[model samples]
Target: MNHESQKTTIANTVQLGSDLSVNRLGYGAMRLTGQPGNFGRYADWTAGKQLLRRAIELGINFIDTAESYGPGYNEELIASALYPYPDDLVIATKGGVLKTAPDNIRTDGSPNSLRRSCEASLKRLKVDRIGLYQLHRPDPNVPFVESIGMLAELQREGKIRHIGLSNVTIAQIEAARQIVDISSVQNRLNLAERNGEDILDYCTQHNIAFIPYSPLGAHPLKRGAPLANAEGILTEIAARQDVKPSQIALSWMLHRAPNIILIPGTTTISHLEENIAAASITLTADDIKLLNEAQVF
Candidate 1:
């Protein structure tokens, strides 16, 4: 097993208000589900429990999940594994997308649905207050403020500690903040995709943590791209550092912004450990330059 035994420290940690202090190196629990055709197929109940426990032992203090993950199975798994959860860990989950049969997905931003989903998530995660509750996506049928207004109400009632948004444009981010505090933004970003660079830059400037989902590019990456496509410079860096391309890619994101948090997912302990180990590896200035250069095109 090629383990990332490097021992480097992050430059700084982001303060998400008074409720939590995130170390910036976090885990994404999306892979903890039995999603069809997912690389990290949600493992058996026993395997899921072990993986969640191992994540904590590796010093990962932050976790990201969604109510749509497993449609509820993922939260129940977290409860089964980490119930009576640690006080220091920050668990972030999102709502707003309604998943039905035959790969059908829809949005519901009605105040009643938002309230009900938040309450149901509480029951599944087995927690009283969500560390970071995010509105998964904007609902075209409903006004953005209307959806966020409901979230704000939840925070006021002691049901949530912080608020976040996902898969939204900068304009949407600004709009949502008008109604509630926006602590973080989760967006699709990876070596092969740089569409969210501007949002990332905006977050860095404002001290908001930018959580990059799919830090590993989605399948069918450009030919010879690293980390996902396995063809990009990430592969080259991995070879040089004796680490996995995925680790190199993750390290790049961590280095890209002081306030960035990575939530790479994995089902097996080996992959999980490898993902966690990226935190300890520090890239050189030359490494950064090389990766950025390849970002062109």
Candidate 2:
């Protein structure tokens, strides 16, 4: 289908790599698992399962998860929701971070450990080949090249269709680019976090899909309160555009770069719909400048 035609298709997918194509709007399954390690704390498993189903129903073909989340709970939930999976859906999962405890997340880039994690992720995801497998973090203990080389090996073996990196530096991204084709880069970025700007710009220049995790801050936004202090720019511009502050925040990211993709996760269906709808709002150049100059982060 043509690009414009595909845009209207919720199941419409876009190719980010030689073998990876997923819907523009996607879901993140981290919240499906319970706090600490169980599945009982957040919401009903049946309800969580329905959330996944609803996301697909809304045309979110890109679903992101990590092995470190619930250490394994998110992947299993994804399998339950998507097994006998849709042909157009893309399942992206991360490795490299090991959860010592629910609150204590550590990065381990040992080649052997990465292989083992990929094997396990494959089993839990119920797919012979992952659509996009990412290295969750760069391991200080292992040479970066060695870690990326292993992912390249997996791609060649048909175990992973594409490779991506998360929480990496520009130098690290450049280094990985040399070892293998990097299709996507996941990083923590929000209206409150601009530390990843350089990498985000680099990805734009290189034609890589930049996926922003936590595009909305983890903090609770007060009801009817502005995103910034009174008279702050976020509120002013959002008011001018007739959009919510969160929508403005997301629209700023999309305005920053066209290659950017957002996977804002929430257990609440209303919030999920709001996040997806942000893509429809357009930010003018002036709107982007105000957001960039706000200096909140």
Candidate 3:
């Protein structure tokens, strides 16, 4: 149970809103929907389902997904895999992005679009109320407040328990609080990207859960390789620690801030186990400095 392992995991526990307490190193379900760019149905549903089951066994209580991911297949995948639903598990699904192809993600944050998406997610996920529902992104075509208003209305109606935002700015968060309390802010952040650092800082100061989507890069890592190339600090520290470069990057994120929650998604059981173990890899202040300066953004 989550209450039992506060001190065991390096990333530790975070209480979202008032009730949902989940492990910091959570699992992202976006990649579960087969790949080419997270827009296609998984090639193997059985493997996808089992992956979700094993993730929970490894202490990953927060599972993140979106309606745009597989255009609805990922939510259905979670329901199929773990739908009796553990008492300690928290399922966070997103909306606002639509999959037009096997590789494209287009933002659609209209309130009607978001409401319809939430209704469908409730059915597909087989849940009366979603633990956390986030807007996938701010839509250029619609007023951002109008979209968040839809999520706030859903919370009042008991369709969503809490609200979160993704790919947003600090100003946006300030504006959104005028409408509803923001529980979490998710953005693409990693050694290769520091664009979300300001957002992460704001979340930390406000006690909002800062969930970083890609703790590791999206592509294959050249682990334990030379650090001479400037952005190779991950490999350099990884070499010193005798772990894979991906682990070092993930571990750094844990040490980077207290409010951060990592959601690193992988298909293979081996990599999943590896990712969960990264929470235990302690990075020193010096190590954090070295990795901190390796940004490509």
Can you list the residue pairs that collide in candidate 2? Answer: 10-59
Summing lDDT over every window of 10 consecutive residues in candidate 1, give the lowest-scoring window: 217-226
TM-score computed on alpha carbons, candidate 3: 0.90
lDDT at position 232, candidate 3? 65
Compute each candidate's TM-score over C-alphas: 0.90, 0.87, 0.90
lDDT of 1 by residue, 12-114 (tens): 4667755578776788877677656222236588988998999888888888987777777777888889988887888898899776642566898778888
lDDT of 3 by residue, 93-195 (tens): 9999888887566888998889999999999999999999999889989988899899999999999998999989998899899999999999888777777
Task: Please give the distance, in angstroms, between residue 281's alpha carbon in candidate 3 and its true position after superposition.
Answer: 0.7
Taking the tens digit of each residue's C-alpha lDDT, what string does model 2 give over 1-297?
443332221223445886566656677777777753422234477888889998988888899998887778789888887789989888899999898665566789988889999999999998899989999999999999999999999899899988999989999999999889999999888777888888989988998888988777654221221232334788788787686777778667766676777787778888778778877876665666667789654
User: Which 10 consecutive residues of model 3 have the lowest summed lDDT?
Assistant: 220-229
Candidate 3 ranges beyond 4 A from true positions: 1-11, 219-231, 295-297
Q: Top model by lDDT, which number?
A: 3
lDDT of each: 0.80, 0.79, 0.83
